[model samples]
Target: MLVGTIMRKIKSRTWKKQRYFKLQDDCMTIWYKSKKLFPSLICVPLFPVSVSDVEAIREGHQSEVLLSIADEFPADRCFTLVFRGRRGNLDLVAESAEEAQSWIRGIRKLMENLENMGQRERLDQWIGDWFRKADKNNDGRMNFREHHARLFSFFQMADRSQSGTLEDDEFVLFYKMLTQREDVLRVFQQFSLDGQTLSQSDLEDFLRDGQLEGDNVQQHAETLIQRYEPSDTAKLLNAMTFDGFLMYLGSSEGSIFNPRWREIFQDMSQPLCHYFISSSHNTYLMEDQLRGQSSVEGYIRALSRGCRCVEVDCWDGANGEPIVYHGHTFTSRILFKDVVTAVGNYAFKVSEYPVILSMENHCSVEQQRVMARHLNQILGNKLLKSTLDGKAAVGLPSPEDLKGKILLKAKKLGGLEESFSGTADDSQTGEVSSGKSPPSYNLKDYSRLCLCVRLLVSYLNNIVFESPHSQKLTFISPVFLFPQKSKQRLSKELSDCVVYCKSVHFSNFKHSHIHSKFYEVASFTESKARRHLRDTGGEFVHHNCRQLTRVYPSGFRTDSSNFNPQEMWNAGCQIVALNFQTAGEGMDLNDGMFRQNGGCGYVLKPGFMREAEKTFDPETPQKRDGYQPVALTIQVISGQQLPKVNIKEDSIVDPLVRVEIYGVPLDQNRQETRYIDNNGFNPVWYDTLRFTVHAPELAMVRFVVEDYDKTSKNDFVGQYALPLRCMQQGYRHIHLLSKDGTSIPPSSLFVHIRITELE
Candidate 1:
């Protein structure tokens, strides 16, 4: 058969890419993309040797030497050769024919070594000795059957088949099977065999006929390498530096690592970071120590190691005093001023600064304005200094002055214009230059201004407006006072200024309208606003804009803990109003905004403060523990009208001239106590029992005189005992039960009480 036909037949059976070979005087060479030689120019003496003989040589000699040869010349792409001039036949196996020739050279060296030892001639004599013993029939040429029978006894364990003869290919296969034991190579070797141990001429005939099976393992391995090189595992391993290995381990599969992985991660990312604990009355700084301070610092340290963000809350107090308190009632009075001082002090104390401070607002509009003004005053100075003095401070800029600060927050739409507009004078100048002036800024008349007032207000940088409602806040540059009148105008104005604003604040703003407006203004020709503004002008911006920024539910009540920082960020709000108790105790504040917990309070955990500081550097951590409650007093203005009360048998009489005490408790148990008239006048009957009959546990008391006689002539009058509970600790629930045990609801004829003790 032609070599090409034989090669084609081998290729078709082996499932390998076709390879062509060239026959040379010395050897046959196979070519693929690259030209690789087989036998490695060494061990050529082994060529033309019987497979059984090679096995015997390998078994009787040092196995390490053969392993070293295998390592040096892998058998996957090896070829075999048969030399005609050797004293005894040697079988050569190599990756390619060229390597087989190299093996011939190795055999020459072995022969030279034998000669140096004065045993070169003994090589032929030794083969002759083995031949005489093995060739029992002595036919001069050992037939395949005789060789196979002779070798069978030596390799009985490997010969699974009881074939009488072994072909050259069979002998090679048996040799490799015993030596390498490679499943792939053994399969190829098995398919190439045809019965008996090969002689020199037989081995040459087999190669020329292309009977050996080819393998595509090299191609497959290269393809596998190509496919997985860009996989996630590869990328992960690639990005991992020696130091980053532990972090990658923790981040990717933390459960697989030891608990000490946290320590390892810390070592990798500098775990000794600081964080600030936002203040709250219920926040026990010591508790944080026990709880393992996981404040903004914990978040930041995690983030600097890579955490996302942190959270904090704010509230507006009297005099626009924005503070950081958590409860509905400020147990601790904290002025925005105190918060500013605390933050400044904290900044001075800590080197690492907070990256973000999310503020939640819980205050009325009027109160918010007051708080905004306070924040403006305190933050303005810091901002100016940072801009001028080359220092850093996370200034809590008013909504009007936010444009200049690197970081600012807008918890609500309240003070955005103040933060972004530079100054009132600058705003005025801009207004004049633009042929418009913001309508007179007044809290009461604000409802009358055009939507532009609100639109302009929403453009402040870093401002966020958070709402408990579902609608998101956005930059409604000209917020329509009434939807009916200014929706179109506001929409148009938004399109014009979309490039200038960050986000719009709205409660359930329509999406279709926004989409339509975007389409309409996409082609609008006007003065170009900054393209980088967060809200408008491209696919990415539009995709982000679909999300609303601020949404305040209509009936939402102000409390501390429910404040959401992410919501505020979405709303473009910077200042957040928070009750002292809720958001103060266990919240993270890292993304860089000033927090004023409306009333004075302290952080529950001192360690948490440190943690927050580490997480969000430059955050102004403050403690507002020193606060006094407001005092209120009330008195009876008049006692002149004492009317006559008439009493009948078995009937109740209503008391006349009832006096209600404000901010005082009544002693219902002392109903029978009486007062003696100074002039010894007729004894007046006082129904003290009936007077004490009000809501049972409340401090309130009531006096009533029921006229039972049905005649308006008789008079019933009296002075009664006062009712009070001096030992009450806190506010108690009052339950007025009927004789049957059902409770009585409040009535018109009830008592009044005021808060007497403010602490």
Candidate 2:
């Protein structure tokens, strides 16, 4: 077991104590127990942690809790275990550095074993977990009551000897009855020769007809039988049992999402503008804009979630450094250098794709220089200081071409020509030389106003005003006017960092086409972008095809709410930034869109949207060239092991499944099933929902389960969303996720999907 350690488990700075820790014999779990004396209790309660659940291990005082106690503990003896999804981190300090390394290496080795497990081994592990949960008394056996009342009747039927507890053979029978689906059984019987097992030829026929397997159906069926059949006799006889069929249906092969799309299979060599980049707005804020906490945690969370573009709002800080936060609100501030360091560390951790730092600069020229210095030194070679291969004349580089690089997106004093010519002053003092009036650059040139940093002004009536870029300003209650200050000089050090994605004032389609370069980008508020989509949808699509466009949430949403990004993507907007800290249907849709192509944070736009000659408008999809619609049919069969939203022991949920489609306006639709009263354990509703998707390429399907309440709004239980194109046909399992998009174990919906082309 190799269990030897006395480590301090830290909950926070003040909450830390020594605990007895040991690794179990299976090498898959670690147990930590409190050493506090309890005369009445027979044994010390031990908490077990599965190595498979741990996402990563950070050495030293990397976490906030660990950093808080850094002065008390040496870095080498400390480590943090980061669990997947929304689980909090676990910080620990060992007695010695060698001890910490032993635990880290041991856990990592067990995790490697878990990752390398075969399909059958994983399924056995899952079943073993269920067995352990059911064996509540630690007796390695389960009775009818321990399995829950929902399966009590089936358990009794399987227990022929009238015993309260079921033996292994009896438990197998009970399990088969508990999980048996009549629909699947009927299909199996139809495909079986003796109405008991599927022979090789029968399996081949089913694969060809039901699964749409082509050419090599016989070989594929043989492979599947050998892989999933639990019975060795079935493998020897080239046959499959009903249990094997069900196992195959629940695995990744039968998942709605195509397994092939779970890798980097997309054409990442296309220009950056030709893809929908996963972008985040005001990424530093963890809550509402007016009053929120700003920390590097927000950056780490977003970047690790495969966010390619993150917004950073920088203002002047103390000691000649710059700070990042919501410009003038009550939101807290974090050092600019810390954010840069965090971004550098986590940029390529999840996906080895380029990251774009969307800079919202409001600092003085001196502080801006400090920000540039932090970016240059902390980020080092990761930051793109110049155009790749000096290809500014060609066009914006592709994601593949700039992998592991960070692009700066902000206002620049001039283009690459001015930056390289050495005509731009690197040290222009922003103050007009002892308080002289600010000189006017070309009044017609809107770039000067864009380049000039804005000082937030607000009335004293406790009223907050939103700046032009959606940053809120807070001031006291007497209405006052803050006049335009002298033009703030641009730091050439920072300006040189903007090789691509230089922010510019977006006037109109004609202005951009005539004057703007491919590397230049424009920002738009949700309202403005919607207006353009309504008026000049085709023109907006054409603009996005050539240059990148970022559409952010409107300033009025101080609550940090997000708008539906699917509509923006429908119009070919490359960067549809959302408040990542906020979780809602908007974030759900964003997660769904980026959940394809290995979630590299870049998904290729639809062929029609990326076409050089713009012919398709989202508003008029029917009139577009080469448009063909598809009919999607989904049969909601049943839900398994649904979680109870209310923790009250006596309370039960009446769950209903809703199928929603998000795509072009014409294809947006929703249909739901009737609620199954007081049955969250195994709810069945053979309800069939249908959708006609006009633009199938841009369509997304979302499955949501809610506890039905006629008196009030339905309480959310779980949901799953994915692109329509990534969906696999035939029978599949839709594994449900919690509200925050984390998988809820043993909770899923089984369904049959069919997509057919329309005339």
Candidate 3:
């Protein structure tokens, strides 16, 4: 099976510098370009060499003929073969060429040996022995087809258990047997077709060949097919139904995909229901716990469990627009219009409109009106008019025209009879006696219009209160009306109208004594009104006078504050509004106003409403004491009999440095508390002291000295503090004081404190 002839190097320029060797048994040559290094080498294999034989020669292959000629061989002697080939030719490549030649020779040698063994039965018997051990099915012979199937089966078995295909134990056993000797290696090589293992295609090729050639290979083919193809026993489980999906979702282990499961199911099945569940704290825990889903989506899933109401806070913007918000500050600055749009889209998608919108108006009247207009635009006349007929009659008017025109219409109708009576006499002759018919009027129609206007104004005022798209919002407001004349006028104008008024602060309604008056003004179904009062406390009432309204409690007060909830509740309070600054953080009105033991409904603060509109930093300091006159320094030394002090009396003082020291005392212990100086030669005059002192204990100290005008007794010329230590027994000299006495230390003079602390 010699595939090619090798060419040995002859005398050449390269050969002179290095020696070359050749081997003829395998017809290959080895070239050692330089062997001044090893000149004793007579011949080495060169071009057109087979790597397999070259490797064998390098492993010290010695034919009987060559061993007989050698006298001695060194242990460290090395040999190698060099081969050259075309660049792109795979077969000519040394490694590939060697592999191909090796495969052919090994196969041919095995066949010849098998033939010499005499009968095919002998080979079959040996194969049967190997197959009995290798085949898990106890097949009769170890053909390539059977071996391929077994390997594939191993992988399949591993796949089934989802474990490693070749375990350590199995790998050890296989390696030990496979590498036993050359005979085993030769047999395995032939079976593997010189490749390491049979791939899927190789297995298929072997099966096809066995089938086409009548090779009695049916057993091997059957085993390969069985192992490689999926059996009827292996089918996937069925997809789950809606009920089944819910059941799965409810189960602990089955809830593995619950987060995305519901949403994915909603996407597929299009469930008609969705919900939003608000948490007390604005933590993303619920959303995070739901496996990276959005907060709203998580809330929807939670609501799908069963929820009819969701609560959200509302903020009023600069233009008196009411926007939904959850906390003290607007977490999201989206306008009320945008919120309506979003909710509308959601409602359209899910086919369910929200029933209630609980809104907490933290906006100004103007802002509320702006947002209300936007909301009315989106919600149409539903919010303004409970019934379609009322809406049509009222007719939606522009915001600008609403207040003036609506009020004008009310006034005109109120004086309708009067106007007719007065003009009746002016009509000439018997013009049906214009006033004689008793001035027929539709009071019901007028009342309906007024009710519509009232409803529209309430809707406009509490834009954040009503969620037309979702039934989740419950309007919450403080009953307190602003002290501004316009605000008061507006409140007085709207007081008769039916609207939900939550008493935030007792003081809001305390002045007007409107708490009891509210109940008397409107009528409610006995049962419904009682229930409303009972549920929300007496502070809450359901009124159906000319319109529909709900009264709730609100105001600013602490949980432990000395306020009575029952009193306020009985007084018809509905809301308790707490000032954000006064109330502690993490404060939650968990059970509504009536629930707290001392909760006087809700604490209401008008100041907080104004404060909410702007951002505040509590860390900033404010000026406290008003501007005061300051006296500049007048220095005086102890030993020198009080150098005449010069003082600038009136100077604008620094805001931070409020106090100024104008004089000092000379006494150590018995210091002069008051300043005294001689006006005349014989008499001493007591003067009111205006200087601060930093002197220690002194005796008979006249540290404070002031110069006053003799005639007017109005102006003090100079003031000074003298150290009494200078006159003491041991003290000979004293430090002169700067004009501004350094009393209380300069470092402590300009300290800053919070306004609250100062108060």
The candidate that wins on lDDT is 2
lDDT of 2: 0.83
TM-score of 3: 0.21
- The TM-score of candidate 1 is 0.21
* Candidate 2: tens digits of C-alpha lDDT, residues 1-759: 354567899988999988877776556667777767333222243677877778789999887778789999999999999876656678999999999998888888887888777645764566566667668787867887676656567878988878788776677677657655776787788888899999999999888777666679888899999888999999999999998998887788878888899888999998999999999999998789888888777888888889999999998899998999876477988989889988999999999999999998878888988988999999999999887886435688899999999999987766776665666556543222111222333322423343333322424223453345565654432212233333446777788788888887777999998998998888999999999998999899989889999999997798999999988998899899999888879988899888899989999998888887758888889898889999999999898768889855455789999999998889999999999998876788989998899999999889999999999999999999999999988778888887877666668898888899999
What residue runs in model 1 are displaced by over 4 Å at the alpha carbon? 1-331, 341-406, 411-504, 507-759
Compute each candidate's TM-score over C-alphas: 0.21, 0.87, 0.21
Summed backbone clashes in each candidate are: 177, 4, 81
In candidate 3, position 325 carries an lDDT of 40
Q: Which residue pairs in candidate 2 have backbone atoms (N, alpha carbon, C) closer than 3 angstroms, thus clashing?
A: 460-476, 460-477, 460-478, 461-477
Put the candidates in lDDT order, highest first.
2, 1, 3
Best by TM-score: 2
